[model samples]
Target: MPMSEEAKALRRVYQREYRRTHPEQLKRQRECTRQWQRQHPEKCREYQRRYWERKAAQENK
Candidate 1:
């Protein structure tokens, strides 16, 4: 199901607050992501390709 605008806004606010209050956790998570990307370059590239495609599609709308 698609999220309503209000739900999306609330999620954005919550995520922003979480990031602001959890710098160390976020740093560790980023480090883990980087390590995983290094260990799976092809998977990372495929994920990035899909991300950019979705971003471009959104912008074109």
Candidate 2:
């Protein structure tokens, strides 16, 4: 997998120099995630769901 221009630009915008040193496969995954979050609100909703689930679980603990 390769990083798209959008992801490269995002990395620069966010000052994520660490992504440069990371393996490209992980970078590609992050890039895909970023793109999906930009293009799909439902994906973000899923993220929110997982977030609340983790939070609820931690609170229960």
Q: Which candidate gets the maximum TM-score versus the true structure? A: 1
On lDDT, the candidate that comes out on top is 1
Per-model CA lDDT versus the true structure: 0.97, 0.86
Report the CA-based lDDT of candidate 2 relative to the real structure. Answer: 0.86
Off by over 4 Å in 1: 50-61
Looking at model 1, residue 50 earns an lDDT score of 100
What digit string (tens of lDDT, one per residue) describes model 1 on residues 1-61? 9999999999999999999999999999999989998999999899989999999999999
Candidate 2's residue-wise lDDT over 19-55, tens digit each? 5566786878999988988899987899899999999
Residue 10, candidate 1: C-alpha displacement in angstroms: 0.7
